[model samples]
Target: MNKIKIIAKKNQKEIRIDKFIKDNIRQNISRNQIQKLTISGKILVNQHIVKKNYKIKPLDFVEIEISNIPTIRDHLEYNNIIAEKINLDIIHEDEDIIVVNKPAGMVVHPGFGNYQGTLIHGIKYHFQNSNMKNFHLYRSGLVHRLDKDTSGLLVLAKNEYSKQCLSQQFYYRTIQREYRALIWGNILKEKGIITGFIGRDPKNRKRMTIFRNDEYHKGKYSITYYKVLERFQYLTYISCNIKTGKTHQIRTHFKYLGHPLFNDSIYGGNQIFMRKKYSNKNIEFLKTFLKILPRQALHAISISFIHPKNKKCYFHSPIPEDFQMVLQKCRKIFLQ
Candidate 1:
């Protein structure tokens, strides 16, 4: 089952539960289906099953769990993912593999709706033009993937043998990944670990849901170790070290901890959730500061592993200019 969780904001006006669901989903879901869900005890308002006609108030948390909802977007790294002249930041290269600093806004691989101008395209073009013979390219050399908007250090295998070796290292939790993320709130703890089960949200196939209870669908066990790097009055910068590479693990875990990454729209991080009292000037300043970073303020800064060929190598990508600018703005805010 998939789950859709929504929290009514203070800025929102009173609305019926059914209408709220449709408005938030932004997809074609009929009222009859919603009614059926209500009957089946699939809709919850503030942790209680609520009727379709129930009027939702501000600050009420609503959750809708369902079984069938098609994802809105589709992409597959199949025949359509062709080579192109895409810009690539090559950090390190060898006969067996290539390490790249993947920038934000570049898709890792192609899919049904998004097949053009991906990192794989660039890799393929690089291989085709190079004199590296005896190299057999399959699976586009990607052992793992980073989200389109997630800038990070990604290692790609050039041959099948390297791919298999690297894949096992990741599976055995030998690869080390450290990410820097700016999240919404100030966490009480300086350093801690978060553990939970994660699976596809039944209400929305586009997102992942965290399961606190083990019975919630035999979900994959996910763990994240976070250290508070810096603390703003309203926001906290953290370094997340993940043990298991579940999809959206860091982002989802931070949200589950009530500190969604800054500007992460998928997990409701875009909303201006602040703790301190706000003045007109403060709000205006915040609006301007937020505009500095268009995407989620998360960066995969460092990755280390036992290389399939070289034996010992570490890759690092500095924070992008946009993310740096956002940090500058936040620092200015703190100083003021």
Candidate 2:
């Protein structure tokens, strides 16, 4: 069992009890868990048990007791094993906006099978010590998200006004997003557009697919325009621009074109080629070394969007190291 304590700051005044715990606590605990703990007299605010949605005031004390202990070591070990480092690179920043270079293999939010050490965790850690408000429930000032395996630029809003202003740009499809990906298979065309309605695959729940005729799927329109920047014997370096954002839009559209990302496990290409390349001699070593590069080669290279405060067009972020590594390897093996 472990005990946790928190002291609310001046800006954190009037923050909901459940939200404060969720934002501050790094344990694998949920809102329901916090609510239950509060109801069961396990959580105290100002040395007294309060309601689940109790609004906290400045200098208020919060204490939480956990019967089943949750350790940060286990979560840290999981991140280390998966090669998800917690280093955030700030590309461009202002009082209203911040653009950060998100690393590969890091989930954007806390979800099922992933509850801690995500980008949300990093952002929370940043705000915990900073002079920022603690009442936001929607992504904590983040305007958009990059996929867990997709590394690159992301813009965050610092205040409520900025969040609304930037969110409108995304909703209006005025934000310009460009991605660079190392996809499997040879491409026939130099440039083309893939337009389709994307939805979750009926057969495979883990993947999103081009829904042909499913009513329940509620397909959303997506468009991806790709131009080949470089070509290898069996791979292509493509620059992709999306007209509409959907879940796994680039990956699904490329897979539909028979060019899945290299090493993508869900949409086709896996390490089967590597397994065939290295047959017997200590397979454990191969797995250990190769697992360091487990994620697909996808990157959000640049994002150009209107600034929330001034409406000025700004671009930020760069191609991450992992994507560059894949390109370098492809050139060495296939082009050379």
lDDT of 2 by residue, 173-265 (tens): 678899988776578999999987787888998899886644422455678999999997556889999877778999899989888887678
Least well predicted 10-residue stretch by lDDT in candidate 2: 75-84
Q: Estimate each model's TM-score.
A: 0.74, 0.67
* Candidate 1 lDDT, 30-106, residue by residue in tens: 77667556644557676555655788899888888664222232123233446688779998898887989999889
Report every candidate's CA lDDT. 0.77, 0.71
Residue 145 CA error for candidate 1 (Å)?
1.1
Clashing pairs in 2: none
Off by over 4 Å in 2: 1-86, 133-137, 213-217, 271-292
Candidate 1 local accuracy as lDDT?
Answer: 0.77
